[model samples]
Target: MELRQLQYFVKVAKKQHMTQAAEELRVAQSAVSRQIRHLEEELGVRLFVQKGRNLQLTPAGSLFLSRAEHILTDLERAVGEVREFLDPEAGEIRVGFPHSVSVSILPAFISCFKKEHPNVKFRLKQGTYTSLIRDVTEGEIDLAIISPCPETHELVKGEVMLTEELLAVLPPNHALAGCKSIRLEQLKEEPFVMFGEQYSLRPIVMNACLKAGFVPKIEFEGDETDTIRGLVAAGMGVSLLPELALRYSTHIEPCVVKVDPKVTRTVGIIRRRDEKLPPVTELFGRFLMEFQPSADPGRPMDRLDGA
Candidate 1:
């Protein structure tokens, strides 16, 4: 099928309205209909079904839509790589990051980079590690900062930036609050507040607890690291979070305790393995490679007041 046909199909699938899709595509309504029909015929599957006056994607259409979007995104990246090769200093860099890294790492990096390359722009997408990885693989983002990289196919490349230790956070009144360090086994019966299962840190916490001989009793889950810390401070449950995440909890700071086994997560940069990175993305990656966390003592998390 033609690339234009796939583009038309994706727009139609997203809008689910022929006239609206055509208007957005800046084409005549009949052209959108004709292209979609041709795509369906080539694939030997009906892409859309009529329900009253509105259009909806059929099961086959839904599946095709994902592939169509991926193809278009890859095509856009291919064009971007060529354009950036010609104009190395100008272009937008799309980056994905989780909340923990956003609070601690991104602000300083962006500030320093902007001073050197004022024309470079950034489009930031904040999400869990899993979503960030998906976005990188799907070509939605040029690079991502994620922790504890998961096993993947040859389509993704990861370069470790640093391994940061995690600390146990407990309510001020909890028995473990006074301890300098506690073991995973000590939290066996304690109610736990944790990142949502979709995040990479959730699995790391669970596996660490499991290795210590008991499953953690997760009592609450949240998408933001600060919210989870708030729950801990409210005496809802205890949790293990990256030290950087602790900076966001200053308002209702939980007592931070070191973990006995010294749990740590590898924070790193990731990009598509087979794709050629744009000039701006490559430069940012090099900056990340040369970054030294210890050199930046101004990071809020470094205070560790409640530890």
Candidate 2:
């Protein structure tokens, strides 16, 4: 019921011995025992059982233990949230990003942001686009680097960080690889490698194919860009991947071609509107919006990477 009671219960559940729990809590053993008794009495169930000095939890205690731990964790998070609002520069921000972004340009951006705002702390979470959108919409994360925006009900502020055309990856000896220019339709009959369903790229690739006048028959699927590139190198299937994805491919080769140029995705920062973003997040958000992929980062990338 009370927070102290929940904390006491958690410690007791872990230590299992009243004397040890009390010592760890820096309280008298009687106090520890009394608190547990009071909690059990209030809940109308026994929380712990004793037969000699060793302590054990009852069935009821075990169930309560799980719920109690969750409650305490949530309570602590709630406290941190308030602190973040009151003093953002000295508080923490929850940031979510796809693993690819985390590897390519995000880590350096985080390092730069941290150098500028050392007191600001980060709690980084990684997931597919669907999961990242859900976290941002549900208020679990303070900010996120999301791409090819997902369907959402939460209010968001987004800005395009950079835009790069989707390019085709092929084996070194593929016929199309020799062409100075290739159309999406040229590779229509070729087997296509794709990102898994959970990724933001899957829909983008499919829709691009649809617009280009054919539905691709997928040959291989994976979440990793490197793996996708590897598959393309092995002649499994060619893939329509963002320029950033190709940044990881050492074995895989990209054919420089001209296309419609309209097919692209913007990777940017997002936050829920109902909650205020901490100062740390705002600073990071600014940095992300200004960041551009190193190859041709039209804006932020140009500024930061000196391209």
Candidate 3:
């Protein structure tokens, strides 16, 4: 019923322990218990039931917890917005991104943005493609750098910033490692190392292989770009990765070969379509639209010996 009561209830729901929740809230355990009791009486439903020493949310309790959390989050954002509006240049921006872009694209953009607006702060959250998009839609993050950006979504809007090629990465000593370009069909007999199903890249690579007339034999699955590259470098299996991911790092250098069919993914930023962004977030969004990565003549083919 009261803001403090909702806060106490949500914290208790999360911790599932009265003492621990009170400890976290820096309040007396009896005060927490009193607030929880008042909240349940106002709602006319038991929010939590005891199991052993821990508490479990009853059905109604679970529902109310969700609403309470949303309300608290909105209130917090409203307060932050008012503070940010007073001095947009010194505000904070929460941005989400996937690991694939973490190597170069994201750090570069942030570095450049900081040079001009050094007082502005950033809170970065790295997640899978799907999770990043979900965070933006749910208000957990203000903006996200997503790959193979969605064409349309009900809750979010995407803007394509750059389109980069996805190339085949082979072990340095593999038979095809020296080739200028390799066709997808040529790797049909070889085992592949690939990103897990959660990654957007997996489906893109799978469809590309499927179109080339074969289902790749996946030998290993990993979440990190560097891990996949290391697997390929050690002859665990070959993989297809974005060019930017391969270009910026020298660790466990694999033989980078161009995909003959030219697979590529669009890198873009997404934000909630319904919400008017905070002043700092809006400025960053505009910068993203106009920003471009500097050109490097270095191609995957250059990684091969005697090219």
The C-alpha RMSD of each candidate to the native structure, in angstroms, is 4.7, 5.1, 4.8
What lDDT tens digits, residue by residue, belong to model 3 across residues 1-307?
Answer: 6899999999999999999999999999999999999888888889999999999999999998889999999999998999999988899999999999887677767876888899999999999998998899889899999998999999899999888899999999999999999998999999999999999999999999999999999999999998999999999999999988877666678899999899989999999987889899999998877765555634321111221
User: For this target, which candidate reaches the highest TM-score against the unseen true structure?
Assistant: 3
lDDT, model 1, position 210 = 86
Reference-based lDDT, each prediction: 0.84, 0.75, 0.89
Ranked candidates (lDDT, high to low): 3, 1, 2
Q: Against the hidden reference, what TM-scores do the models get?
A: 0.82, 0.74, 0.90
| lDDT (Cα, tens digit) per residue for candidate 2, span 1-307 | 5777888888988987778888999998888777777898899998888858778889998999888887876677678768877886798778999976775667667776777788887788998877887787766787888786433444765556666677777777789788766788887899988988888888988998899999999978988877877788877888877766555536445453444535787676777766656565666777676666665433223345562
Task: Give the range where candidate 1 is weakest over 10 consecutive residues by summed lDDT.
Answer: 298-307
Off by over 4 Å in 2: 8-37, 43-78, 81-90, 137-140, 155-160, 248-258, 294-300, 304-307
After TM-score superposition, what is the CA distance of residue 144 in candidate 2 from its true location, in Å?
1.4
Candidate 1: where are CA atoms >4 Å away?
1-9, 30-51, 55-71, 295-297, 300-307
